[model samples]
Structures are given as C-alpha cells and as structure tokens.
Target chain A: MTGRDGGAPLEPLGNTPVVILVRPQMAENIGTTARAMANGGLFHLRLVSPRDGWPQDRAWRTASGADRILEAATVHESVDDAIADLHHVYATCPRPRHIVKTVMTARGGAAELRAATERGLKVGLMFGPERAGLDNEDMARADALIRYPLNPTFMSLNLAQAVMIMAYEWWMAADATPPRTLMTNETHVATKGELENFVSHLVRELDGCGFLRNEQKRPGMVRNLRHFFTRGEVTEQELRTLHGVVRELAHPRRAED
Target chain B: MTGRDGGAPLEPLGNTPVVILVRPQMAENIGTTARAMANGGLFHLRLVSPRDGWPQDRAWRTASGADRILEAATVHESVDDAIADLHHVYATCPRPRHIVKTVMTARGGAAELRAATERGLKVGLMFGPERAGLDNEDMARADALIRYPLNPTFMSLNLAQAVMIMAYEWWMAADATPPRTLMTNETHVATKGELENFVSHLVRELDGCGFLRNEQKRPGMVRNLRHFFTRGEVTEQELRTLHGVVRELAHPRRAED
Candidate 1:
C-alpha cells in the first residue's frame, strides 16, 4: 500500500525489470543502488520500509545524477505489495541459502529476466536489507533465486555492489556485443578503393625512397602495410588525412605554404 | 617508491595483473577498491600517488574486512614505476577520447589479460584519478585499452565500481569467455605504445603538410586520426610495415637515393 499516491496506484516501469529494496537501512546505500540501476538501464525502484524512512536528503545527494529514478520511486508497505503486479520475481541471494527455490547464477537469472522482458512481463528483482539479507519468509515470495558467483572465501558484496552486478548482468544478457563503430558521426567509413589508393600511394613513396628496396621482403612488406590500413576500415575523413599525410611528408606544405 | 617498505621492493602478488589506481582521491574509494578486488579474487593492489596519502584509518574501515589487501598494498611515485615489473598493461577508458590503442570490451579484455597471465606475463590493469581519468601520456604505456560496455546514456561508474566490475570480469574470464580471435595468427599484436608512436609520426607529418592547419579544430581532428589507426589491432609485423611506410613517405628516395 503506497500511502502517498492518493487514489491511484504506481505502475511498474514498462517491460524493464523493477528493482525492490526491502528494509534497506541507510540513505547512502539506497541512493547508490538507484545509481547502479540507472547504470544498467533499469529505472523502476520500489522501497519496502526503508529504515531511515522516505525522501532522505542525503539519499539524493549520494545518488549522483540519478535523481530521476529516486524521484519516480514508489514506497511500498510490504514485499507482497512491492511485487503484487509482477509476472515474475527474482530474489538475489548468495548460494548457500538457496535451498528452497530454483537457484540460478546471476548470468542465468539475467537471461531469464531478459526473456521475461521480451515477452512483456512485469518482473521484479528483489534485494534485502544491508544488515541482514532476505529472511526466509521474504525469500519464499520469489519464483527463483539469483546466486551471484562471488569468491567463496571473501563473499563481501555490499548492497549497491550486488544490485549493480545484477543490473549489469541484465543489461549484458540482452545486449549484443556492439560492432566497433567509429565514434564520430560526421564522417562516412572509407570505401575499399579509397583504402587501396592510400596504401598504393604510400607504397609508391616507399619505393621511391628505397624503404621497400629489399626485393626479397618487398611484396610481404607491401601486403602487411596494406593490411594495416584495410583493418582500420578507415573513414573517408581519415583517408583524406592519410593521402595528405603522404603528400606532405614527401613534399611538405609545398602548396599551402 | 614505497617509502614505508624498506630494503626489498614491494613486488606484485604473482601472475595476476596488479590493479593500479592512478592518483585516486579519497580513503573511502581506495578502501572500496581493495574490497572490490577481494570480491573478484584479484590480489595485487598498487596506488599511483593517492592524493589523501596512504594508510588512512578511514580506508581500512571502509574496506569492510578486506584488510589483508589494504595491508599489502604498495604505493608508487608514478604510473611507470607502479607498472615497472608488469609485462602487459591495460588502461580503462569508456568514452569518446579513446585514441592510439586497441580498444576492447571489459569481457573481451578480461579474456585477453587472462591469456597473457596464463602465459606467465605479469600484467597491470590501470584506472585513473576520480576527478580526471588517465591522461593520454599515461594511456600510451598500456598494451591495449579496456572499455566497459556500460549503458551509453548513463555511463557513470565510480572508481571502486569500475575496479569491481573489471575484477569480476577477470574472474569470470577463466572459463566463461569464448576465445578472443576467430582467425589464426602467429605474430604478437602491437602494444598501445607501438600503435601510439605510429599515430604521433603520422600526425606530425599531417601537421607538416598543413592537413591539420585548422588550429581551432586540430584536437578533434587528431583524436579522429588516432582512432582510425588504433581500431585496426595491428600486429608487430604490421607496425614495422607502418613505420617503414611513414619513414619512406617522409624522407623518400629523395634522401636515401
């Protein structure tokens, strides 16, 4: 029961899995958790009885620039109300206590959440308090448990770190490893012919300068030199620079000067 | 030089890449970096001139039981001195300023560093100061760069979280990552320094030729030019080819003949 929202109820952030912090104590941790969620592109935040109570001044300060997530967060009276509308729920727990649920690694849980999001299901990712993790009663509410593969000897993950890692997994599970795109949008990628021309231009200079004078190694050196430019998949702007670079080195600012 | 540890130098903890924080600011951040390293099984920690000074009471307190790592951590006067014993190095830079190095995703980088480690190479994973990240000069020392695939819209990872995720990926890399390259190759890939030298040489020639004469726009143009070359992942042989190409074009048979 969110007491403040008047007659209407707060809704889950569409498609994205909701992050629920149950009885989290410190404002700093909550703020950092919200920041972590934003980093992983998860927006919805639901708090179940934060110990320091709601709208803590310090919380917003700790959240860095993630003010929007904290601003839209809904407070819940209980865990049951927190996940009331969710089609699926995942509780993050270290493996030893995962006897009751269909235990999955964080990676496995991320894939499950990704699938649920694609199917348009309302999903909840629950994290317990800073002092004590989810109680047995609270853990029982989840459909499955996410056991992060942490070091067995030093299993010391803070509340924000756990949420951050889980959120990272969620983002990574859905994301295709992006093909390396040239960061600048201004220039078009160079054509194969453009690259060949640049390579040929440089080779011609090498020949003239006697840099490629060794007959035994000339062809191999030429091929290797060509491969370097070809692999960059140079942009038109870069190729232009290269062409100019060759011309200038052979005959410095001869025209512009 | 670690002033406190007299006689023998503080050596890194075996084959794992020593986590080097370049001028990290706060005790809290340094403490958390150690904690994060512990969580992911990374043992070595090196501080490249921590601003607040070392052995701070607040750091160990904030580390939250990651005391052993903090205790054994070594402080260095410079980035080079910190990475002196390391055979391979990686710098993490997530944004548009990346230039003159092979760029890799955190996952991809973790696998690579892991391979280098398995081959008995001591490695270094470098992070920059909180307020300002690594300078281009500092970046020039690395074998390559590690760029985390963060949510592009909200890519605000703190110092400790950055180290944490990298450490997590390092541990995850042992079995989880697929092999790095699809093609068969023998010659070693060029290090960031080698790649950077080629970029600087070409840029100088471009400058001499007046290709980058637009003073107001030179910085961006230089960055773009470096990016074009860095993206290629040129090998040692290719780098040699490129050096010859640059030399031949600049001085030409006009000099050598």
Candidate 2:
C-alpha cells in the first residue's frame, strides 16, 4: 500500500496497538498529535480527561484533515481506564521514575513496541498532562518507560512534537534498511571471475613492459598486485580504466620507449 | 554562544548564511521554522513585520527551548532591505513562476546555499506572507526558489514544518554519516586472521571425526569451507560458539560416544 504522502509504500502494522494519551491538556496539541500520528500511518488514539476539551472544536479545526483520528479518539476518565485492554503499556517520561519496569529510549521503545505489535500484542503508548505531566501513580500502570534524551534543563517538548518524534522513529524501524535505488547507469562492480581475468591481463602487461624480468618472482609479484586490487574492491569502471593504463604501458609510444 | 534555553552548546554555523523572514504571519510557525533552522545549526534569524509579536512570543513558546534563536532574531523591512548586503538570496516557492530567476527543491537549494555559505558568501532565505506566500513579484527579488517535495493534492505545509524539513536535510548533509550514538550494537564480525584460525580448528576437528577421509581433496574442502564462512561473515561470538561445537565433535564425552 502506498503511504499517505506517497514517497514510499506504507508498511503494514500486522497487529500494532493504539497510542493512549493520559490527560492531554490543549485541544490544539491533541489535534497536532493526531495529525503527527496520521502522518506516520498510526491510526489509534485514546485520550484520558484532556484538560481543555475532548471532541473539542479547536482540536477538529487544527487537525487539518486528520479528522479521521479525531473521530476515532477514545475518551477515558483515567490512565488505567485508557490502557485496561493493552497487553503492553509504555509511558513516556523525560526522566526515570523508581519503577521496576523495562526502560527504553524513545527509539528503542518504538522498536520494541513495533515488534510486539507485529506479534499481535495490544500495545499502548501513554502521554500525560501538558503542564504537570504524568505522576508516579499514573506511571505505575505502564509495563515499560519510554524516555526521550533531551536537554535536561529544557526538556519540555510540546505534545505533538513528542508524538512526531516517536512516530518517525517507528516508521524508520518498520523499514530498517532504507531502500537503495541502485545506480543502474553506473558500471557494476566486477565479479570474482572478472577480477581473475583482470589479474591475468595485468600480468601479461607487466611482462611486456619488462617489469617481470625474473619469471620465478613474477608469480609472487602478480599475486601481490591481485591482492592490492582485491582489497580495494575495484568497480567495473575502475577495472576498465586500469585496463587502459595497462594497455598503454605494454604498448608504449616510441618517445616513452 | 549558548542557546537561549541554556542547554547544550548550539551547533556552529561556520559560515552558513542566514535567512531572515520579514513580517512573518504566524508566531507558532515562526517557532517551528526556528526549530527547523536549529536542527542544522543554521543561525541568524532576521525578522521584519512579524504578526503575532516581534521577538516572537509564540515562536519562542513553540521553539521548544530554541530561545537562542529568538535572542538572535534580526528584524528587517523589504526583501531587498533584508538581504541587500548578502551575496546570494534563495526564495522559497510552492510553484515555479516564469518571472523567477530559478526554482529548486529545498534539498537542491540547500546544497547550493551551503556551498555559497562555505565560500563566505552571505545568503538569505526569503519567505513571503503565509496566506498568499511569496508572490511572483516578491519571489523575483530572490536569486533562486527553494521548493519542497509535497503531495500534489495538498502542497501546503505550515511555514515552520516546511522550514524544519529543509533544516533537517541540511543537518543530515552537514554530517553525511548518522550520529555515532545511533550506530547498532551488534557484535563485530570475525577478521581475516580470526576466520583463518577458526577454519584451521574446524579442519582439525573434522579430521578427528573422520569426516574427511580423502586427504587428496583436503585443499578443495578447505577452500569450500572458507568460502562458506566468508559469505556468512560470522561474528566473533558466532565463531566462539562454532569452536565449542567443533571441540565437542573432536573430543566427545564418553557417554555421548
């Protein structure tokens, strides 16, 4: 399936679960976070006692075509209520709390969450209130802590921005190896057989140039030359260029001779 | 200089030119754009005719600790007035206009701008009003246009998001390799020497097991074994595990035998 943006194909999330927000404050932030989630092809959203509003007009206005997310946002009274059905719950925190749970960086958390999701586990990502954020009591509900490494002094990230960062990382993990468009126009690297041919050609050129005066040492010298080129992993274009150089040396002009 | 948030040291601009937006429309957007610029350490914000507030109240609020940007904002009037002393001026546009000198992608434009900046040339990024963006007339003032690759259905992006994307690409260019911290922690593959040692051990174990009875084909067998391991790029940990298996095979326990 094509991504919403169409730059790449959408990666299917076989069983990845929703993101749960525990007491999000601003409607605009909710809207933006929803948009960010949509941008990364994450569809599920759950809100717990959002401060300003839920099913908010301002949120709908700011959602900017991500109304589908707003339409599907599940509302709950408390953090526990939001993640009651989840097999795994990850709470986002700036710093570590005294919790006996797996602690992962945002990237690591996303990766693990994605893996769990693929295995058909219901996962939830919990965010807290805008101003004060999640309390220790709220964090007690999580199975893991997702910590973002930011400047300690200025660690406050707007809700949507945080969502975007996590979502982007999840998207990247889904396609860990970036698809490389091969340079079809460029000469392909020579195979082992081609390298052997090039070595033989080079040896003949060296003999013609009187460089291999001693036949016994010629084999050793040729082996060393082959090792040098092999280590370089010379490309087809490079081998072609080397062939030209060898031809020139073997059949030199009278002036050079 | 320290960032306005007074956190980590800001990435140095070296000689990258600054793009000053005069009379920008939204403060939140300005903040977003500033964050974008900060992504690549693109210092020098010159503002003129800001809408919500000068020194950008909303901008700083949304900048997420990029206060140093607000501290460094330089206000200006007309487009020419903003970049009059600068050697190069790149204007951003959603579409190419016949009147503009040239139109380029944010990536292409950034590459050119970076080159010019590296040569100690002053470069300015011109952004027009939000609702109308840069008019063909206003865009004429710039040397080239920086266009973003967006969905054709909706080419528009909030000013800050657009800025952030460009800044991100520029930052990636500044460091061609991913951050060192981002490297995977997988075990190192065995080196040539290590592989040779493992192969010798494997051959001895196989001989002890009477697996290789024909000594005449030993050289070919060894070559084949080397090829197999070389193709796999066995890690040091994997080799150790393999060595244990080989030792077990060579010196079987009395019960197992």
Candidate 3:
C-alpha cells in the first residue's frame, strides 16, 4: 500500500498474527476492524459466520481506503477450521471461562507472539462477536487469553478499538523507533538559572503589588510558586512567553489600547 | 449505564479529563468517538466548532447507547473557550507542527495526566479534525503533544481509535490491579511442597524412559526441565493435569480403549 502522503511503499501491516473475527455482527465494525488492523500493520483477517454476511457495502464504506483487508478476508464456518493450522492461538476474551488457560496482557501477548513468529510459528488472535464475547467453546480452543486492562465498571470496548489496541501494541513492539521524544528541535529547554530569574522577577513584581502578604510566609509561598513553574518543564521559548504574559498582567493599564 | 450482563450500575465514565474535538467534520465519527470514550470510562465530550454542527441524528445512531456523552457535551465556538479553565492541556497530534512543545507518548501523557488529577488539576485532551490536524496556534495552546507510536507510512488513525487508546491507558494506570494475571480464581498457586512432589514424579518418569542419558549434564538437564514448567506458576490443578499426562505417556502400550 502507498503511504497516506504518497511517500515510499508502506511495509506490510501485521503479518504475524492472523486476526480471526468470530461471528462479527456489524459490517461497519468489520470494516473498521480491518482499518484498525491495517493501521497496526496487521493484514490477514479471517471471519467465522459473520452475522450480516461478508461482502457488505457498508464495511467498505467504513473501511476508509483499507478495503484491501476486507477484499482479502477469508470467511470460515467455525473457529476450529479458522485456526486449524496455526501453531499458537490467542483468544481475546474479557470474562473468565470454565477452563483454565494462561492469560496475558496485550503487551505480554505481543511479546509471546513475537517469539513464536521468530520460531516460524503461525499465530492466530481470535476475537468474539460484539454482543457477547468468545463463548466457552471458542475460549477452550485457544492456548491463552488476552484481555485489555480496562476499567472494571465499564469493560465494554468498541470492537474496532479493541482490535486497534492489540494492533497498536504489536506495531509498537515490532517498530524500533521511540514512541516520542521531547520537542526540542527548535529551542532548548530552559535552564534552572533562566527559570529562577523569571520566577524571581515575578516574585518581586508580586511583592510590590502586595500579592505576597505576610513576610513570615513569603519564602514558603515563593517555593510553592517555583515548584508550580518547575513542574511544567518550561522551555526557553515558553519561558520568554511566560515573561511576556507576566509583564502584561503585572503592569497597570493607563488607558492604553 | 448498565453492564452488558445487567449486573451493577456503572459508575460515571470519565469525569476528570475533558475530551475536546476541534472543528470536527463528521457526525458518525463524533458518535463513535463518544462510544470509544465511554468504553474507556470517559464521559466528558467537548466539541469546538463542529462542521456538521451538534445534535445530529447520525451521531446518536453511531454512539451505540453512549448518548449520555452527547446530551451532556458542551460545545464551544473555539478551542480556547473549550479549554479556558483546564490546567493541563494535551494535544493529540500525528504530524509535527511548526512550534516548540513538550512531546509525550499516549502512555507517558496518560501518566502525566494521572499525576495532575492527583493534584486536583483539570485536564483537557484536544484532537484536531480528520482532514487537517491541529494548526500551529492550537498546538501552541497545548502543554504537551500526545503522539501515538504508529507506522510511519500509514500514520493516519481513525480519531476514535486514538481517543480509545488514551482512555484505556488512563483506566489501566488508575486501576490498582495488574494488567494481566493468572486465572487463579478456582485454584491457588501450587505450593512449593506440591511443586516439588510434581517435579520429583516427572523426573522419575523421565528417568525410567532414559531421557537424562548424559550423566555429566543430568543436573543441568533436570534444572532446565524444572524451570520450564515452574516458570508458568503452575496451579495445583495444572500440576495434577501434568501428572496425568506423564502417567498416560509412561504407559503408552497399556491403553485400555
């Protein structure tokens, strides 16, 4: 696939895990799921008895240019046939089942999948339908369960979002680039000296305006003020902007427009 | 909202971090974003100059019972008014803007937001429109940039997925329970005594089979075998199952069936 900005050809999305959607209901959701998978670099999508049937127009409409996934999707009759050839299988389940199975967070599961792929093992990640997640029989077929650490009170996740989370984790684990770096391209971070100078100037102006009342409590107040600014990790440019803001706010307006 | 299982009433979804969508273009996307936020226990939805305008029927249709988010949503004419009172503001930006700012991954930004909430600071997470992301002026207003570690080639993410990621991280960080844990509800972790007994039984069975043929490496071989099973923190029932497997394998020719 070409990049969104028409850059170099895009690397294949998730290649290791064959994402099997069991009895997915909504075509739009299936489409979104495909898009999510593509976003995470996951390609192979298998469906098991979709409620609305495959080749739905809405799925393509919602897929938003990721129809390649849908077009290449394989439909299956049962979960057994879906993962019959896979060496490692993970069921994305939220509730506990009757059987005993290894459970892993998405991160741990991705790491385990990576190891399996390195050993030339085909892995499948199964997701149940949106209405009720994987049934007991479906859960029983998997080696382990992968559950997102969601708020217990509100454990429901949009199916595509769930797929996206797993895909994102897998992509992040595979990609070697740092997730983010401090935006230090244009200017340097403010030094302690610069921060202190700005804080001292503000304190002096505040004191002149009687903002720092009670001389005995002045030092503690100043320390608290300094702590607030320091916690923000003010950059040199931001500090200058803050100085300008302070100067404007501190000065009295003498009928100046 | 009641859970899918109709158990307990859900606590209010996101109350701390206000989600502000700037110049949103689509109603369905807005709806799904609401649903995603609700899935992550976030309810506060703020819209800044929505293109299709608020109270669209399509948004409600796609929200999937997350209309509460829309009903209580506050719409503003501008981003500044939307986040006027927030102490901490994070901009979810996929592309770099021509400005100097602090950059953090979604996980790091969530941690920072969690800390700010601990200090009773109100936080606002701003996301730009679908076509064009936040402009330089909008980025300038934010305290930090929350970047998702996405595939460089296919960097575009459906806006709701982005929101869901942040919400999931926030919920996980706030929740005290570990992300993934062994399914230990029915059985306790096998005690050392039980583990030792199983190990001894397994070793005896292996010895009878002449598996440890090399006398020089016998100790290391046994140690390696022990480490393999023990690493999983095998439960009592699992140990029993292993024992059954060993017994069946040891007497292969005596199959009664």
Candidate 4:
C-alpha cells in the first residue's frame, strides 16, 4: 500500500561523508553517536583523545549493534590531527565564543556541509568532551560553527542527541528521496475519497443495525469519526480490507460478504 | 518561560489513568510498552497474564527509568474482570473485527479517552496476547477500537512504540498550552517589525562582507537565510546576542584579522 496520492518511490542521497568525535568523554555516548551516524548512512567514525581509548568495552556495549562503526573507527590524539586530511570542518556550539566567523544554525550548517560534500570535499564535524564542551581554541580551528536554537532554560543536549539532530538534518537535505514513505504519495491502500465512501457505507450499515440510537447525535459522532480517519490518510488496500470486514459484519451469514 | 505568543501556562495533566496488559508475551516488549506509556505521562501500569509474573526482573531492567510503572503495576484475570467499573474501555487492533461500535486512530482514541477522563470517566485501554492481538470476543466487550496507521509492508510495531505515539499526541493536545516561552502580555520576541529589521541588517552585513558578490544571487540567498531565522521567531534576547556577534564580525580587531 502507498500514499493517499499516487505512490512514488522514495529517493534519498547515498553519498555524504561525516567526521565525528573529538575528545569524547563516555564510551556509551560514542556507541550511541555511532548509531545516530549510521541512521543517516554516515559511516566514517573519527575519535580524538577518547577517555577510555580505542575498542573500549563500554563503547561497544552502548553502541547497540552498530558494531561496524566501532570496527571501522579511526583514532587520533588531537582535533587538528583528526581532520588533517579533510578539506573542510565545522564545529558545533550553542553560543558565540571568541571565534570571529559566520556562524550557521544546524539547518544552515547542514546545507553548507552538503554543498561542500557534493563537490567531493572531505567534511568533518568536531565535537568536544561532554563535561565542558569544545573550548574557544577548538572553535577557532573550524571554518564554521554549527548552532541550534534550543530552549534557553535547558539547552544542554546529550552528545548523542546533538549528533542525531545534525545527522537528521543533513540526511533530510542531501537525500532528495525519503528513506521512508512520507504520507503524501497516491499509491496508498485507500485515498481520502475511498475512505469517505467506505465510511458512508459503514455508517449506513450501523444505522441498519440500530446501533446509532440518537438521531441528532449521529451526525456529530459521524463527523468526529470522519475527522479522525481523515487525519490518518488511510490507504487503498487498508480501505478495501476494512470494506471487506464491514461487509462481513453487515451480512453475518453471507459467503465473502 | 511560556509560549512565544504569550499564552497560558502549559503543564501536564496529573493522575492520568493506567493501561493494563493481560497475559502479554516478551519481556523486552513489555519494557518498551512501559516506555511508550511514560512518554505521554500515562504512568499507571497493570499486568495480567504476563509470560513472566509480576515484578519480572527482565521487564524492570528493560523499562529503563520506567521502573515506577513496573512498581505500581496491578494484576487482573479476565478482560471484563479488569475493566468492570471503568466507564470507558478501548481495545487496540490493526483492523476491524466483529466487535467494536466505534473505530478510532490512536490519536483519536487518546483524545476521546482524555475527554472522557476529564468528565470523570474511568478509562481503560486493553491489549490481548502478542502473537494474536485482541480476539473478537475480547474486543466485543470494549466501548471502542483504537487503530494505528502503519506501513502495510511492516505494520507490526513493537508494542511500546505504538503506545508512545498515542501517548505523546494525547499529552500534547490535552495540555492545551503551547510549549514556547512568551515575551510579554501582547507581544513576543521577534515581532514582525523586529524580524524585518534583522533581515535588513543581515543583508547589509552580507553585502559588506562581499558574500553577496553576485547581484542576481543576492535576493535568493538573503530570502533563504531570512526564511530560516524567521521560522524560529528569534527572541528579543537572541536578537540582541546576534547583533553583538554581527557587530564584532563586521568590525574585527587587527590582531584577530
């Protein structure tokens, strides 16, 4: 079953390289970070001054089956060392520090990074230790700062969450086709028109069964139901399946009713 | 802080009802289900027919911080026995069967349940065995059917994810207050006038930096950047902070240069 509209194949961008981690604090966070990275097809894992060193047990345990990342991870001793071969790098920070350059929000950062990667530029994202975050000197090493609008009261996001947000945005922009079906396609099991027809039929059957006792209340109740179904964008196959069920219920003894 | 539009306080609805699972299979699934219920503040837990008995060590370990739900869980035998005094009862199913007068999506089901509860109705959501969801006989006793929109290719969601989606939507709508911080009684940060000023300033800054080198490309770039910032409805404090950074960049020190 596809979308309510005509179903179209989802196309997502397949080629985007990512550089991750700089002096990460916890192994579990690194594992989760890898999972988030893998979610968007980002494969490259770079580590700098990890507290527990390479192949840490805690990191693998937290990775939750994203072992490929741990196996492929490249370790470094410094931020500069981590991205020495990269053509471009972007550092994430919540607020302005001493760095004097154009800062971009995560959305903007993703756009710029995608453009760079499309030109075959090796782009890296530098993160700092969990406790104090990236220092001002670290921010100065990057060409751009990636920022996000967060709740001021509590803008401190866990390292993995921050990575996920950036990765998600990059994936959304670079991949023209969605990995998962959006609710906009037409190949769905039932379209809005089909659902309305089925609902009409179902309501008539209910009326015949004398299930809707109050005549005035029927319209409101039916309207509420219609509103509910409309929000879901029921597909064609689902509609047909539902129609078959309703038919059987309407005619209890009929074969294939 | 409150909604950016100066709305009323947004707080959770306390003392939301519990969902009881009877004879559920799989400890991992139960933990996930508990997490889902917790996502939307529906924290009461009751178990009946669990493959493993009450206070299952596996269930608690899987539940993460949702141990509260496991601790508060009550046990029951039959469906009727579980919800005997409840004014409203909903049974979740992927498709319709012989039972259920009203069919609703998880969102609709949760909304209705919330309203009923507000009106002092004791509401209960029931789930049958995992291998086969609620049976027709079991569904027949419920007041309504809660349906979820899912991909036909893989409609089977781990029980908890299903619960989370419903709970999150219910909590979001029921709270009634927006989740943003309000600026003042009548106006919030980034009023239309302020947004306009920021756009003008940003454009000027870009032009000064020679980033707007191409005359034809200027409008599109400026428009895109403006659209990005405006979507966030930048707060007054945020604007002030941004202005300081822009000023510093526009007039950098010789040592920094």
Leading candidate by lDDT = 3
lDDT of 4 by residue, A1-257 (tens): 00111232222234455556878878998987875565445668899888888778888786645577778899988887888888888887765543345466665677777888888888888777776778877777887777655322223345765675566556655544321122323344466678889899889888998877799899898888788878744567667778889888888765554
The CA lDDT at A213 in model 1 is 98
Instruction: Report how far off residue A202 is in candidate 4 (Å).
Output: 7.9
Model 1 residue pairs with clashes = A209-B252, A209-B253
Reference-based lDDT, residue B224, model 1:
89
What are the candidates' C-alpha RMSDs? 27.5, 19.2, 5.6, 11.0
Scoring each candidate complex against the real one, what DockQ results?
Answer: 0.06, 0.04, 0.34, 0.06
For candidate 1, lDDT tens digit of each residue in A1-257? Answer: 00111222223235788999999989999899988887787889999999989989888998866778899999999999999999999888764332323667777888889888888888999998886788888888988777666555666788889998988988888777742334435676778887788888999998988999999999999988877766655677878898888888887775568
lDDT of 4 by residue, B2-106 (tens): 112122222224646568676788877777666556545676766766777666678877664566667777777777777887888877766553331456665
Model 2, chain B only, scores a TM-score of 0.75
Q: What is the lDDT, from 0 to 100, of the residue A154 in candidate 2? A: 39
**What local lDDT does model 1 show for residue B257?**
72
TM-score of each prediction: 0.69, 0.51, 0.76, 0.47
Best by DockQ: 3
- Measured by TM-score, the strongest candidate is 3
Q: Per-model C-alpha lDDT, please?
A: 0.78, 0.67, 0.81, 0.65
The superposed Cα distance between candidate 4 and the true structure at residue A30, in angstroms, equals 2.7
lDDT of 3 at B124: 84
Judge candidate 2 against the unseen true structure and give its global Cα lDDT, from 0 to 1.
0.67
